[model samples]
Target: AQSVTQPDIHITVSEGASLELRCNYSYGATPYLFWYVQSPGQGLQLLLKYFSGDTLVQGIKGFEAEFKRSQSSFNLRKPSVHWSDAAEYFCAVEPSNTGKLIFGQGTTLQVKP
Candidate 1:
């Protein structure tokens, strides 16, 4: 079984400030991890993914994440936030073969100018 947990329900960051969103997961083995962003009234867009090799993966919109197997965590980060970055972020895990994903509760980011 695979599960994701995003501890923060909401977060506020000033425009141009650095941001980091925490995520944790539990699975039977090494699972595929991903980060997705969904703006209001919009569909989820894949931010980044970790399947193998490099622990650090770069994503679109200047976002990146690192998979820490020891900690069972994959945290998303951005060097600078923008007002347009406000949205709901979800961390998900794929158990493979099931073609399904277990998603976290989601963290809503509010960027203030």
Candidate 2:
């Protein structure tokens, strides 16, 4: 079984400031990690994902994440924060061959002007 954990339930970042969201996972095999963002009253959108190759993966909206196999972590980062970036971000892992997902509780990002 695989599980994802996001320590912070909420995060606040000033506009133009750098932001990072933490995520940890536990799985028996090489897990497919993903980051998704959901704006208020909107559907989830894929930010970035790590399946293989580069440990660092680039995503939309100036977001990127690095996959650390030893640490069992895939942390998302953004160089600059914008007001529109405020949203609920979820860390999920494809746990089974069926591509079933196990998602973390999610972290809500708050951007301040």
Candidate 3:
């Protein structure tokens, strides 16, 4: 079974500041990892995914993440925050057999200018 946990329920960041969101997962084998962002009343958009090779992966909107196998962590990071980045971020994991994803509760990002 695969599962994900996001420790932060919500976060606030000043515009143009750095941002980091935590994610942890439990799985038997290497899992397909993903980060998604959802704006208010909108669907989730894929930020990035880690399937094979490379511990670090970059995604849209200048977002990136590093996969740590030992810690079972995949944390999202951004160099600069934007007001448009204010949204809900979710961490997901796909199990080895099934294509379905198990998602975390999600962290709502509040941007302050």
Clash number by candidate, in order:
0, 0, 0
For model 3, the stretches where C-alpha displacement exceeds 4 angstroms are none
lDDT, candidate 2, 1-72, per-residue tens: 568999999999999999999999999887899999999899999999988999999999999999999999
lDDT of 3: 0.96
* Cα lDDT, all candidates: 0.95, 0.94, 0.96
Each prediction's TM-score against the native? 0.97, 0.96, 0.97
* Candidate 2 RMSD to the real structure: 0.9
Candidate 2 overall Cα lDDT vs. reference? Answer: 0.94
Model 3 backbone overlap count:
0
**Cα lDDT of model 3 by residue, 1-113, tens digit:** 56899999999999999999999999978899999999999999999999989999999999999999999999999999999999999999999748898999999999999
Which residue pairs show collisions in model 1? Answer: none
Of candidate 3, the 10-residue stretch with the lowest lDDT total is 93-102
